[model samples]
Target: MSVTSTLGNALSGLTAASKAASVVSSNIANATTEGYGVRQVQTTSVSLNGQGSGVQVVSVSRNVNEGVLADRRAADAAYAQAATLASFYGSVEGAIGLPGDEGSLSSEFSQFEAALVEAGSRPDSDARLANVVRAAESLAGTLNDLSADIQSERLEAEKEIARQVDNLNTSLAQIQDLNGDIRLQIAAGNDPLGLMDQRQVLIDQIATIVPVSVVDRDFGQVALITESGGVLLDGTAAEISFRDVGLITPDMTVASGGLYQVEINGSPVDSTSPNNPLKGGSLDALFEIRDELAVSAQGDVDAVARDLIERFQNSAIDPTLSAGEPGLFTDAGALVDPANEVGLAGRIELNARVDPAKGGEVWRVRTGLGATSPGDPGAGGIILALSDALSEPKVVASGSFSSIPRTAAALASDLLSTIGAARQASENEVSYTAAKWETLRSLELEGGVDTDAELQKLLMIETAYAANARVIQTVDEMLDLLLRI
Candidate 1:
């Protein structure tokens, strides 16, 4: 080979080796960086007049297993959904109070029952009557607090949905901008590796909010579509919209137009629908809490409140009650309108006629709710009657609780049991999804930049650099000898 040809070849070799070393070092540095892909330097032999001349550095490319990454993103979304559901169920269970827990529904009922017995034995004792009244208030307070808590969770879920919607819109817009940048870079023959890495990070974030599938586009751009075939982004980002109701009540629901559902590209879609495009992510889970889980819990509590109200209102148990009068438990100070009993739990309170705190006499517990004056001192029929009514098995109303006849105490216990079972099931799902996410993540990492492999490539690059240097040195020595001769 001519000296000039040898010199050109060695120079190209050195340049290629330097590029390779740079790529290898980058891989090592970003091994643990989230969303960073392994890089490789592409090269090809240069030919002039059909003769091999030298080498040329073509381009740098990133290496990532798209299939594994997609699967990992899916698992991550599933884990997020399961964790959200588990949190809702756990919160409800805590509010309802587990069995044997103080201030729990069952405990409150037990205390009320015991107080009723004590008051009945000493109906003339003002202290005993007052104790009975306080016990009833405690029971009512428990239900009131529980109902309020459920509504609070629902409101929080609504707020979270709004936040996620805003976040999703912002991310989609950013991705669109990145797509334009990537397309321009690719067209200009630039690397665009860093922009691609940033895009991948944004895509992964979108996946956690709503599981999506990426579609490759012209000029290295991408389009995001949800698993249910909703196009979140193509050339432009689809605007996601939601209205936070601010304050959710037990009676407010999507069906009643009280809660606003999610909208996509200006088209309203029910977020709680089974066929929602953005299912299997935290967004969907939030809707489940706002529209389904909390509503059902409130219904259960309302049913218990209805049971309490009707039992005391029954003329068979309390003849003092008129045909339309409230019993020991009133719904917001009036007779419970069975037709409008959605938030009865929050409204259920101790009958004001029997509570001095509400400007009623405690003696009313021993006397009658409608009595004009104090009844006979030995008269404890009202207390015993209310007590017996609570313990008696009866069919409940208004809620999805079992249709079978059950006592008030049994109904409360069943509500707790149902919540506990659901919580357990959701936790099990969380465990499964979490394990799956970890496994898929590990598989993804296994395909990421391996330090050992990068180091080995570095050694090869060093060898190539040394060989190219030796070639140049040899050429220099040959020229020097020729000049000396």
Candidate 2:
């Protein structure tokens, strides 16, 4: 090669190496930055007629995997949903109390059992019967209040999810717009690094709601897509919109799928199945809360109530008289059906506390049944039979007050077991969700920087830069000598 040509080649090499060093420095500077990817300056040989000329920087490329990145985004959305749902359920578990605690349902039922036994000792006494009635009402009230509170919390979560969805859609649209600007600039061969950085930050934010995949297009353009292969952004932008939707009815049930559907440019999309990769965000969490935890919890409450009502009514004591001789007591009434009441969800009230002070009256408990007194003599057989019924296995399911004399304690034990089972199910859900969250977090960090590795690359770049500087210095000295000759 001629001297001039050789100098030109050296200059080009120096420029290319300088650009490489700058890229390495940029990587090292952002080593700890979240969502920052390593940048590389691609170079190509400038050749003519099979003759080497010099090197030229082709383009700047970011280190990222479109498929893996999309997966991470989807995982992020699911993790957020699970995390939110778990947190809310955990709160419910706290309110209900843990296993073996006095604050638990089991402990409360034990208190109810004790009151029943006390009343059985003086079945003829109005005061004792009143106490029994009151205790039953209190227990029912507690269950009603707790169930109502759970439903309230679920409503709040639903609203929060709807708000978040709107915010997420706004962000997605913004990203699409940025994509358009980036493509336009790159098509004209302009450096859009700043815009690209902003877009990457937005993608990271999107990942927090749902996972996404980024496809590098020509120049500095990027196409954003969902893990499900839905085109979130191509050359143009699209709008995502959300609406406040209902999921559960007053009867405590999941509404139809249409209740929580999402829309894009007026077309509906399913957001239930995670595998189908619905829009990633807190919406997923709300859906699970409404459909899974809330529904199951309601079922558990109904089961407990049903068991109590059935058992108590079956074993309840009913006094009989000879030719209607004023009855054994004025309040010798049968249990009321709980299911007829708004709160019991079709359960029956077996033992309601009667207030004897307000005249011999039947107490109202669990929507129907209350304490009763037979004003006449010879009501012993009826009371005894009732007591025997309570002694059977189904009092927790039956609501029978008759077996209070012998089986009170056993019934209380069963109540405890049922409550424990419900709480355990809630805890299990929380545990599983935590594990899923950790896995997603690890995936997020996979494409993120390793500071140690980046620092090593920085060192190598620094050494090359120094060597290139020395070469330039030597070349300058040689040029000076030749001039002198």
Candidate 3:
């Protein structure tokens, strides 16, 4: 080969080695960077008249463990879902309080029962009668507070859904923009590895919100589809939409249009069903809290309210309370409309005739709710009957509990037990999902860019560079000898 061709070959090798060195240096620098892909410089041999002339630096390619990455993303979604549910259950269980705890639902019921017995023993004591009224009010007020807490959770979930939808849209749009930018870089023969890394970050963000699957497309672009076959992006990003219902109530529901639904390209997607498009993520968990979990909680508490209302409203228990008339407890100060039992827990209140704060007499506790006057202040008949009604075992009229007879306090205990069971189950799931996520995450990191490996690659690149430089130096010396001759 001519000395000039030899020089040209050395120059090509120098260029290839320099590019390889740059790639290795970048890998080392970004070793701990999240979502940064390890890169390698690609090369091909140049040909002249079917003979190798030199080396050509082709493209820089990224080394990504696609399988591990996919598994990690799925684990991310599962962990998000489990964590959200566990948090919600923990909140509810905390609000209800443990058995025998002060201010707990069971404690309030027990206090009311105990107060009733005290007043029945001293029926003439106005203070004891007032204590009985106050205890009853406390029990009703506790139910109201619990119902309100559940609705608050529903409202929070509603707002969160809206926020998540907006974020999902923003992320999808950003991904689409990155996709286009990556394609442009590829077309211009520029390295798109950096843009691809950024795209992966955005996709990981989206994965926690909703599970997605990536699909390879031409021109270095990618498409995303939900696990349940909902197209999130093809060539263009799908517009995810949700309407913000600023206020929510127990009566409000998505089915009745009181709550909004999540939409994809203007098509409704059920957030609660097993076939939900965006399942196994935080967004789905929020929907479950709003539409299913909170609603169920409200149902259980309202059942307790219904039992309390009916227990005292019986003519046999309180003969003075006329048919369809409220007893010791009233629904918003009136008789309960069975059709409107959805929010009864929040609306339940101590009957006005016995609530001194409402211009009623405290002696009404020993008399009757419908009694016109304090006929006999020392009459303990009515007070003892009221106490019996509270303590007697009776079948509940509503909720998922068995129809077997239970005292009012026992029903209260059952509510706590039910919510506690759910909370424990959810906590268990959180533990399981968190472990799975961590294991997958550790596996992915184990396969990630290794600084030591990158340094070794750097050493190889340096050797190749030195060899190329030596060849050029030899060629320069040979050319000088030729020129001198």
Candidate 4:
């Protein structure tokens, strides 16, 4: 090869080597960075007169597995959702007073059962009857508190969903802007590597909120699409909007698009319904908590309440005490003669209690009386049923209103078991998913990072640079010899 070509090749080698080193340094620096992926330098050989001159950097690329990234994101959503639901269930556990001694739903119901035995001994004794009533009241209060707690979690989940959607929109917009910048840089023949990395980071983040896919285009531009076929970015971002109506109460709607939206330039795009790839994220989890679990709890509450009211009133003394039998006392014992036996019906109330400060307590029974005077037999039975319902093993069917306490207790046990099982499943999932993530990370390293390879490249570049320096030295020596001769 000609000396000039050799010199040129050596110079190219030095430049390429410098660029590669810079990329390597960047990778090492960001190795521990969250959401940062390793980077690679692409090199091509230059030929002079059909002989290899030296290598030149073609481009800088990211070391990423797009499919793995998508999978991780989906997993992230599921983890978030499970975590969210678990947290709410924890609240429910506290509100329902699980794994405790006193005032717990199970314990309270047991106390009510004990009180009933005491009441049966001397049904005529006012003190024993009052004790029974108070126990029933406590049970009702617990139920009320539990129901409230579950409802509160549902509402909070709704709010969180709204917030996440808004944040997603912001992230997506930033990605579009970055894409534009990258395209411009690439078109100008500049290395858009840094910008690409930043955009990739953003995409990874977006995946944690929803599922996503990327389509590469010329000029370093990439299109962002949701798994649901919604275009998040095409030249510019696409617009996405969420329904304002809530999963629970239609009237109790949260703000729209607060969690996430895709905007393409200025136009909006609708994400695919069930086909939407955006599944794993905190937003998805919150939706599950708000819709499925909370709704189930609400239905249970309604069922228990409706059944209790319907059963006792039919057979128990009516809310209105007659001329012979006096109506039950209110807060005080002063009683007016019942206008009719139906007075007992109004006296019954579902009494439950819960910790207002905590998140998860719901479905405790409280005062059975709606508007009737207190201490009537029917009202008393309603109160007793509320107390014992948590421990009983079977559902209190509509036909057997008096058997509510036993039914409720059985149902409560079943509910608790269901939650326990769900929590266990979540724990197993987290472990398995974490292991899978590690496996993917290992696969990435196969072609991702190798110190030995980098060192080999370094040595090759150094040899070329040294050979060129030697040529210059030889040229100087020959000129000296010519002068001396």
Candidate 5:
């Protein structure tokens, strides 16, 4: 080959080697970077008259397994959903308290029952009556606190949903911007791998908030769609919106037309409905907790309160109570109507007529609320009847409990067990989904940059660079010899 042609081939080889080395160095540098895809320089062979000339750098392309990436994103979303559910359940369990804890509703109910038995044994003792009243108050306060906590959590979840919606919009906009930049860069024959990596990172971030599917477009552009087949972005991002309801209460429910709804691109989406587009992500889980799980828990507490109110309201249990009049237990010092069963737990209170601290007489325990005169001070009849009323098996109206007759204490225990079971189930799901997500993430990393492979490639690039330099040196020496001749 002519020295000129030889020099040209050597220079082309040198340029290709330099570009390959750059790609290898970049791969090593970003080995640990999150969402970074490994890159390789594409090369094409040059030919002259059907003979090999040299090699030319075509383009730099990122190495990414789209299928694995898609699976990882899906796993991320599922894990986020499970984690959200588990977190909410844990909060509820904390608020409900464990069976043996002092503040637990079950424990307080047991204390009240014990106090009633003691008072029943010594009906004449004002101290025992006072203790019974205190225990009843404690039980009522515990239920009230739990109900409030459930509602508070619902409100917080609503607010969090609003915040997440805003974050989702921002992420979508950023991704769209990057998509435009990448298309422009590709059209200009420039490397767009860096922009593509940044875009992938944004996509992963948004996946945790809501499950999404990615579609590849021409010129390095991508479109995003939700798992439910709702288009989130194509050429531009769609608007996501949510209505925030401040200071939620038990009465505020979707069925009652009190709660706010989620909107996507100006279309109302029922967050609680099965067809929700935002399913399988943290946002969906939060909505479920706020509108469904928390509401059901509050209903359970209200049912317990209704059971208590109804049990004591029976004149057979407390003859002093007139028909329709409240007995020892009242709803905020008033008779609880069966129609107003909601929020009963938050309103449950001890009858003031039997509570001396509330300006009533302790002797009222022995006498009926309707009795103008105090009955026999030593009359253990009413105390025994009250104790029996609490311990006797009775059918509860609350659907949360079995319709079969059970004592008040047994029903409370069952309710606690139910809550505990739900929390346990959620925790188990969290563990399972978290493991799955971690495994997928590990697989994705394994499919990413391999430092050892990159090092080997770097050595190859160095050898090629040295050989090309040798060819150039030989060509230069040959040219010098020709000049000397």
Candidate 6:
């Protein structure tokens, strides 16, 4: 070989070795960085007339397991969905209090029942009658507070959905911009690895909000489509929008103008529908909480209030209460109209006639709302009858509970049990999905950067660099010898 050819070969080897070392250094530097893909220096041999000419650095290719990455993204979406649901249910459980807690609905009902029994035994004691009124008020207040808490949760979920929509839009726009940059880099034969990595990070962020499927396009460009078949981005980023309500009430619902549906590019869509493209992520879970789970909880509480009103409105329960007259438990101090059962829990209150604190006579507890004057102070008949009305098993008109007959206290326990069961189910789901997500994430990290391998590669690069430097030195000595000749 000619000396010039040898010099050229040595120079090409040095350049390739330096590029390879730079790639190794980059890999080691970003070993712990999230969303960083490992890069390798791609090299090819050059030849002239069947003889080795030199080496060429072709491209800096990113090492990634596409299938494993897709699996991890899917797991992230599922985990977010489960976790959001569990959190909302946990909040509801906290608001309702534990089954036997003093401030809980079940506990309040038990206290009321116990007070009624005590009042029945001491019918002449005005203080005991006063305790009965207090217990009744506590029970109503517990239900009202719980109803308000549920509505508050709905409002929070609505606000979160709006925030998520904004985040999703931003991510989609950034991804689209990255797509343009990456495509340009690829077409210009420039290393687009950095842009591609940034795009992957944005895609992962989008996955946490909504499940998506990625499709590769020409020139390193990618198209994003939701698992639910909604196109998020093709040539341009799709717009996501939501109309957040200022306040949420128990009577307001998605179908009843209490909430708003998500929109895609000016088209409205139901986030909870089975066909929703945004399913399997935190955004979808929030929508289900605001529009479905929370709404159902409100309905159940309203049913309980309706049952209480209907039970006391019975002529057999309180003979002195004329038809249509407010009973001991009334809807905000008015007779309950069965037609309007919604928001009943928030409006439930003790009849003013039996609530001394509400400017009514306490003797009305025994004499009844329609009674003109107080009945015999010593008469235990009316007090005993009231106790019987609360203790006796009766069929509830509300469809929220089972059709079987149950005492008022038993029904309250059932309501608590229902809430507990729902929360437990959500907790189980969260545990399972979280484990799956972590496992997938660990696998992805394992497939990312191997520091040991990178070190080994660096050692090889050092050897090549040393050999190339030695060749260049030998060539320089040969040139010096020729000059002396």
Weakest lDDT window of 10 consecutive positions for candidate 6: 309-318
Q: lDDT of each prediction vs. the true structure?
A: 0.90, 0.58, 0.90, 0.57, 0.87, 0.87
What tens digits encode model 1's per-residue C-alpha lDDT throughout 1-485? 78999999999999999999989989999989999999989899998878778899998989899999999999978988999999999999999987679899999998988998999899999998889888899999999999999999998898889899999999999999999999999888888989999999999998888999999999889999999899999999999988787688887887888888888988888675677898889999999898888888899999999998888888777777788788888998899898989899999999888888779998888887888788799988888988898899998876888779999899999999999999999999999999999999999999999999999999999999999999999999999999999
lDDT of 3 by residue, 1-485 (tens): 87878888889999999888888889888989989888978899998877668899888888888898988899899889988988898889887898778898989999999999999999999999999999999999999999999999999888888988999999999999999999998899887899999999999999999999999999989999889988899999999999888788899998888988898889988887788888879999999999999999999999999999888887887788788788899899888777889999999999999887789998888888888898888899989999999988999888888988999999999999999999899889889988988898888887778888888888888898999899999998988998999
Clashing pairs in 3: none
The clash count of every prediction, one per candidate, is 0, 42, 0, 83, 0, 0
Model 4 misplaced regions, further than 4 Å: 1-3, 35-37, 48-55, 99-101, 122-128, 242-280, 314-406, 445-447, 451-464, 483-485
How do these models rank on TM-score, best leading?
1, 6, 5, 3, 4, 2
TM-scores of the candidates are 0.98, 0.72, 0.96, 0.73, 0.97, 0.97
Answer with 2 or 4, whichever has the higher lDDT: 2
Question: Model 6 off-target regions past 4 Å?
Answer: none
Candidate 2 on 97-124: residue-level lDDT in tens? 5446755555556656666566555556
| lDDT per residue as tens, model 4, 1-485 | 66566667767766876777677667666655655566778889987668998787887776777777666665555555566666776676666666346777666656766776665554445566567656756765666566667667776876776667677778878988888898888778887777876887787777767767788887778887766676667786655545433433411322333333333344432332464444546666676666556655555544444333433332143333333331222211223222311222123343222122332111111223333323333234443543344333544543212343445455555455655666677767666666666666565555455666656765775676576667667656766898999
Q: How well does candidate 5 match the true structure in TM-score terms?
A: 0.97
- Model 2 gets an lDDT of 0.58
Q: On a 0 to 1 TM-score scale, where does candidate 2 land against the true structure?
A: 0.72
Error of 4 at 432 (Å): 3.6
| C-alpha RMSD (angstroms) for model 6 | 1.3
- Model 4 TM-score, all chains together: 0.73
